[model samples]
Target: MNLKFIEKILIVMFLLTFGIIWYDFYTFSQPQLNMNPDLSYSRLLEYIKMGWVKQVDLYRNNRLAIIEASSPDLGDRSQLFRVNIPIAASQLIQKLKEYDINFDAHPIPQKNIFIKIAYNLLIPFIFITSLIYFFQSSNNIPGFPNLPGGPGAFFMNLGKSPAKLTESTDDTSFDDVKGIEEVKEEVEEIVSFLVDQDKYTLVGATIPKGVLLVGPPGTGKTLLAKAIANEAKVPFYNAAGGEFIELFVGIGASRMRDLFVQANKNSPCIVFIDEIDAIARKRGGGYGSTNDEREQTLNQLLSELDGFKENSGVILVGATNRVDILDSALLRPGRFDRIIDVPLPTRLGRSEILKLYAKKLSLDETVSLLDIADKTAGFSGAELANLLNESAILSARYKSEKITKKEINEAFERVIGGIAGLAMESGKIKTLIAYHEIGHALIGSILKNHDNVEKITLIPRGEAKGLTWFKSRGDARLFTRAQLTSRIITLYGGRAAETIIFGKPEVTTGASNDIERVTEIAYKMVTVYGMSSLGPRAFIKLNKTRQFPYPPKPMMSVKTRIKVSREVHRLLKGYEKIANRIIFENRIIIDLLVEKLLEIETLESSDFYNLLNQYIILPSK
Candidate 1:
């Protein structure tokens, strides 16, 4: 039933309950006074004899009487009183006749048949129906699977696996994916295994039971799993790790077993678990630290992978951003033998991804996918897709016939900087921001290792009052010490410029983010990259509390810590000096760029390059 109808039923039931209570209170509200046997019999006689008794209701098998009387002391006022009759008063009917008092007798009341039926049956039925409807219409209870239908269906599905099984006939396949060539190659073997399992068995080569797809989020791990299933033309079962767990402890284990059984029935099938870290977290966490349900579920999953007859034609594929936290037992050779790392796409890969998304859009021929790829160096496949989607939104908003290159770039800006037209500040703040951004752009233009400054804007975006974006020439896999140092110098350029223009004390907190990035890079160089005098060892300790990959903290003595701190300081100070020198030498150019920035609010790479060409010779690395 619809919620509105159920609600009306509930309201009617509530009103009925209230009306019954009120009617019951009003009907059974008669007042009575009690008197002992001797006194009651004497008063009864006196009232009847004096003709003051109007009527008497004999109850309790004639042993009790409710007398409606008018006594001398009561002065014609009718009073309702109860009196207990002695068994010796056998002539009570005769006494009533002699005293001329009207009398009646009644047995205890039996409830009305309709009220009895309503109380014993109808109310409970309504209550149960309403409860079932409530559970059905409301959102899923925490830790419960979102089972469709009513309460019966919910309870019926409670024990069943939450994994969603799909046939390979569905549309997603290798063609739907792009940018991850190596990942596709890694999983292609699984498809071959599923397509012809007997061929592998005849050659005495066993198929890998599990393929662990590890990467940062939005790198297409789940999509790759689906594509593998589609290519293999096998039944595919997809489930998140969290869905296996519930408020009940053993339910997760039960679910894992059920999922395996189903996959086994549909042999040559693929089972994909997204975010496996939810259940596959390392076992033996400290006392009271590990979740029993999750641990049990993980144990069951391990069993299903390599416990018995090797699961025959079942291929298990798991994906997680944090592979570090997974149980080592699950990662061992037999379980997840092939560990496929899906890193962020390279420049060419990003270009491919853009092309894939662009095919659906009415993109202009003038719009260069290669250019957009260069601008989005660190973007993942999913991010690129979202960028295209946002661009389409912008196109629709402007009522444009085709998605222009300008819309694509604006979409990029919106994704990185929240909303457009948000940066509307003016005057001194604007001038300071202009100088800061121009300083970075000028230094980047002068440096050979640094990427070309793509665009500089004095208008605020995100948390900054200005921004200087550098478009990558290509995806550089390795960074030299000179390149890292150049990056540090570029970071300091903004603060250095502010210090030169407004003096040391007047530098704004806008450079705090820059300082943070610089500190991280410096720390990584010394401890992780081992570029410092400290040694070619990673002395930093990884965080044990979390599974998300983060830079390790240094595990060192106080004296060594002080030494590392000194080195990092020296690096930052030296870079700052380089930045200051650059700013000091290009003071006039900085003023001109700031003026141009203030007037236009934004400058493209060509604008900055033209001005740089007029004043300075480009340096060689």
Candidate 2:
């Protein structure tokens, strides 16, 4: 169960083994000789009558005897022999006493000092330790219980829920969380309902049975749930969805029932289940399904949520990144009525988060939170926190007392890609990558609709040989067809530059990721976004209820599919031509950017744009 308990058990076993070994040695050490049955009893009487017997040691309640006799071969030397006393041998001890023969009625010692210590001291010590372990285990100290044999034999309370009942403390409040204001506001209203239900009840409004926090991973969903509990000053019951499902059947359902019962007992409380997708996957299983336990658990959860009344005061909050795989019933009107989308933070939110993390760090006066936030466009809250921590680690590594802007930027790159290591050293491959990345940057800078070229680097990061990042000059909610085409053209710039500089035959597979992004955007534009010749209606549905479910018997005919393919192909070719033209016209600028990148390995937004402005002439739009 615990280290101390296990140590005590081992000690007890060791003492027992030692005692057994001692007893075996003691028994084996007793000197005895075998004698014929009649001769043994008759010789004992003969020796007693002849006065040759020196001493007789009687054991086994005096039924057996070790006889010490004088040996004639060695004149007066004594020898030892054993004999079993017969029923008529009752007179043997009396005859020995009448003859005045030396005799001892010593019982062979059952326990010596060691055995006595083991039995009296070690056994009692182990018993006390066992009692302590049992009581500690009964209180659930996060380990297997040492119940007699092992944990496997102790499954009496296996059906009990593993959720911990915790009362929220005032330490973690809304002020601690910096970004995602909209998410905070929504959860804050839930806290209001929890704290003062009468305010909502006057309008005949009922609090939602469950609130589902759906977002990508690392978006601080669980933090918001804790904030709600803290604000409401209610009991918080925490459990992961995986904890409900077990290998045995019906265990999951039993746990679900137990959790609800406990939550109901602690009314005016919040039950937060993180990663609910583990048990709440879509119901209908096909041929090779082995999720019977999980399905039963989900069914129980659905039943609990459906059966809840307004003033029951037990709110269920579930967080998941994979809501698409969840059962539709879980997202219906009554259960999980509020589906809050906790999207990634914006630029302002990132700035706030950076500043909040930087408050504890000794940052240099030159460090600007706004500059760091501007470069980290798509970073989540967790990534941002990790970025600051990495910056501090770098600072410590360099023996600096404070974090500088340079260290923060390096850490940012490490977080986005990976730590800088041995890249291709000024070889043909390095030059090729430099040109490829510069091509993307040049195209982005020249195209008005495209985002501003953020950073261009020849240094390898992640799976790419080189990377060219673009940042939105302004946060535009909608993208026009022109803007999408400009992005596709920019994506093609890498391949186009390779073909232009190193001949068409020498173009490598380095543009695979770029091609993938371009294809996805093109496909989405045609079928889903309705941005192509296929017309204004969406030809493909998202269908979040099921994963890769069959299409509803082809909404469009074969001709429509052909049309969509043709449109996608046309957009790709058209963008390729535009990229080729841009690269050809700005060949000097592209070459200059590549040369600079090869020298420095990385160029920030200001450096890249300044060099681009020197060679490229802009059209006054």
Candidate 3:
């Protein structure tokens, strides 16, 4: 029986026993009386003295008397009267004898020994039973295996692994996974090994025990694991790294052990732990230093990985975006033999992903997936899926039959910037927003190393009053100093335009985000990229485990820190001056662009560049 069910039964039985005992005691103490008028002791004495009493029956050891008497009120008929007799009723008995009244004294009935014992012991028995239940609930008592606090408590299952076992099926195969051709190729060998272990073992080559999938969030790390399991055609136990952690001591380790035990029992299976960094973080002082439970769980996981035999047939696949913070023991050769990086999709990859998702949507003939892919350079596979989903939503919202290029473009803007908000009315704020965005487009277009302007609009989107997008020039891996400096100057353009048009005192906080980006770029150039006059040296050591909003303190001396700050400031000032000079020189074109932008509320790259071409020559790379 379930322990909780048994506990309920005991409670009901105790209540029933107590009720029965109390009912018996109440009946024994007060027997049912006859239907007679109650008389006072004085009235009874008067009746006896007047010779009106006929007979009497005493009960409860002379404490109650039933008297049969005749009086004028009774019309000479004998009537029974009940009276509560006093302790000293000898005189009443003598009077009854003198009156020749027939009296009989009934003895008190004896109670059952068991009922007496039960009535007296009910409270103590309840107290003792409660103590037993309390001790058993905490699992402190022996010989009570089926009680709470014992081994049978409901919470005892907390130590069990919460991994969901997925039977091998062709529901999700590699064909469904798009935009990661290289990553698919990397794991194809593991699938082959799981299919026919003898193929590799015949040549005396051992299979890798584990594979680590590292990538940014939403880059299809978990999807890749599913694909591998489906291709292998084996039982897949999927669990999150956080599932093994518990508030109770040793529970995390127990869960970790249970997970692997089940994996080993079902040999030739795959165990995929997503977000492994949650438990496999680097040991010792840092973020998880105070969490001994997580440390012990990680230790247990390492032991299980090490215990795997060359032919155990249990392949472990772990995924995390923070591989840098994982313990060295967990990532060692035998533990996580192969480390696969699933990076953001490239241009061609994005196009493939878009096409795969576009198959489900009712797209217009002019809707081009390639064009949308080109605009989304750094989008991951999941993000690409969302873009099409958003486009379809917009199509439905507008009651359109099919998704057109216009819907896709709007969805792209929505995804990149945020949801479009109400457009600002024409006034000082609108003019200032128009000038700010135009300044960014103007500076970006004139820069020799910066990306080309894609679009500029005064329509508010997300938190900004206006927006300007720059077209990415493919997936450029390395950036030059000229390119970095161009980006910084472009970021400064908004603030410079605000200062020039409205004066420094009237400049709005619209450029706050721009100022932050400018500072980050300038600081990176001086402290990280070694592109400043302070010599080619990195002053700030990168701490992968360091969380944001609380970065690790700089290790440099006061003089070095002062120099780094001055260099960053100098970089920002120089870029600001350059942005001001360019904007001031092209004030005529700026004014023209702002007027056209306010009227149409939007300007494409071609239209923007065409207007600029009539004034100044566009810069060459």
Candidate 4:
């Protein structure tokens, strides 16, 4: 819950308590008379002219009003009024002596308003307190709405772990997760351990104390962890890293203690944390503020992990894509013990994921899963799943019962960052884009080392106004230096083709991404792979480098960094000049290809190869 809602509920409780206390006070103050109705004092006084029924006190402020009655029957009920009313003994005795009813009012002198406040508002204050206690006691209630989006500013623990309850409501299992056979086999080892702890224990080997599931988000890291518990028929306690921390200084540490205590009781179970980075981040990296709750939470977690013996039945499982960002202390040899790397799904894995999500879809004859897997070379398991789901939506939108290849292609475009909207393109611009794409395909055809360009389309996907897709015969792997350079030349081929044909630069800055791709290749070739004639020394890493690869120490002088940058620009310029020459000599092919693109806005790889038939003869040795 959020702070706003909590405040509202508190206000409501205060008002309710005040109302109940006031009602009780009025009830106790109702007038009662001891005289018989026929011999009433008011009636006798009326004959003598004192007629008003004034000051009928059921309660005295500090003491009971001691009326010197002719009758002697009121003493038994006297103590009851003393306890209920604000009352003193001396004041009652004085009233009887003077016969003036000088009873002390609860003497709430301006000096002692605190006492009167306690007496008058005690019931409401107690009522408000009990309500607060009731909410605190029911901390485990799940799925409570927080006031929109603050920390658990709502009631306690409501939004914390939708994980445990989702087990009953969420029917997903291991079959839904795809890829990484090695990692799945590793997780199953833990499952086998949980199934029969005695089998491993008899040999003096306690089951591995903890298993950390590490991978990129949407790669089924947490899903695989949950499936292990579901398959074992064991309980699961799931929480986010952030959920354990709160604003109260040591509240996070307290909650960690509580979580582990409860988790240990349900032994032979799995405790999974999604996004462990929030709690397990390398400490002392954050600002050195005194009230750093996340650091304290991490400290408590380290304590809990250390507290567990090898024989302890509880298993700790954590998932995070940014394994590098995690603290080395938390991932030390004995604590996390095993760090399983979950990678993106392979083609076969994608096929399986597609089939699973497509179980509810009506697939047409041409909607081949293998073809999709081949086309989607770089998609992760999650992307493929999303592709299938989007295809189903497209089929429904078009009012087709069966999902078709066309719809699947459209869905692929959406998954790939969606089509560049129509408002962003014009007819002449479309023709230019089509020809520019064709230029890349033509160059790809002539260059024996280039991967086969698959499809060239003016209909954009992602932010690009046009795209040229290429496919190699096999699975995607790290690109070789030669392959990387060839790819960059092909990227620049579009803009290069425009200049060679139109005798001017007709292409737009859509080639900005193309130039960026080219620059990286040049940088990598020179700095990382030692592919350049410049030899293998670089001032920066290609992986981290916006400038170069095989990064050198940053302690180097600024002049060295600038020189390395100059070398990168020089390398890109060399490739661009050579690529321009290649397109210049083959201007006829570029022209014909553009004519064909103007006629047809999109063309497949076969169409490209067919048009460049004359230029396709084997390159002379």
Among all candidates shown, the one with the greatest TM-score = 1
Task: Give every collision pair in model 1.
Answer: none
lDDT, each prediction:
0.83, 0.81, 0.85, 0.67
Judged by lDDT, which candidate is best? 3
Candidate 3 lDDT (Cα, whole model)?
0.85
Question: Per-residue CA lDDT of candidate 2, range 176-220, in tens?
Answer: 777799888888999899989998999999898999998878888
lDDT per residue (tens digit) for residues 1-621 in model 4: 443565666677577666755754654443244433233323323322321221223234433322222212433232111122232233433432344332233332232464366557765565665555555442333343322222333434432333342332356566666666677888888888888888999999867667888766677887888888887777887878777666666666776777788777777688888888888887877564333788887898889999897868888899887776688899996689899888777788777777777787889988899889877866777788788888888889999989999899888767774754653344667767766787788777667668787777776666787777777555656667667777777877887876776656565776778787787677666656666665666544432113332234443478865766677787778777767888888877777877776677677778877777756563321
For residues 561-596, what per-residue lDDT tens digits would candidate 1 score against the true structure? 898899889878888999999999999988988888
Pairs that collide in candidate 3 are 136-148, 136-149, 137-148, 137-149, 138-149, 139-149
Residue 89, model 2: lDDT of 63
Task: Estimate the lDDT of model 1.
Answer: 0.83
lDDT of 4 at 230: 83
Summing lDDT over every window of 10 consecutive residues in candidate 4, give the lowest-scoring window: 79-88
Candidate 3 RMSD computed on C-alpha atoms after optimal superposition onto the true structure: 9.5
Task: Evaluate model 3: give its TM-score.
Answer: 0.78
Residue 253 C-alpha lDDT in model 4: 75
TM-score of each: 0.82, 0.76, 0.78, 0.73
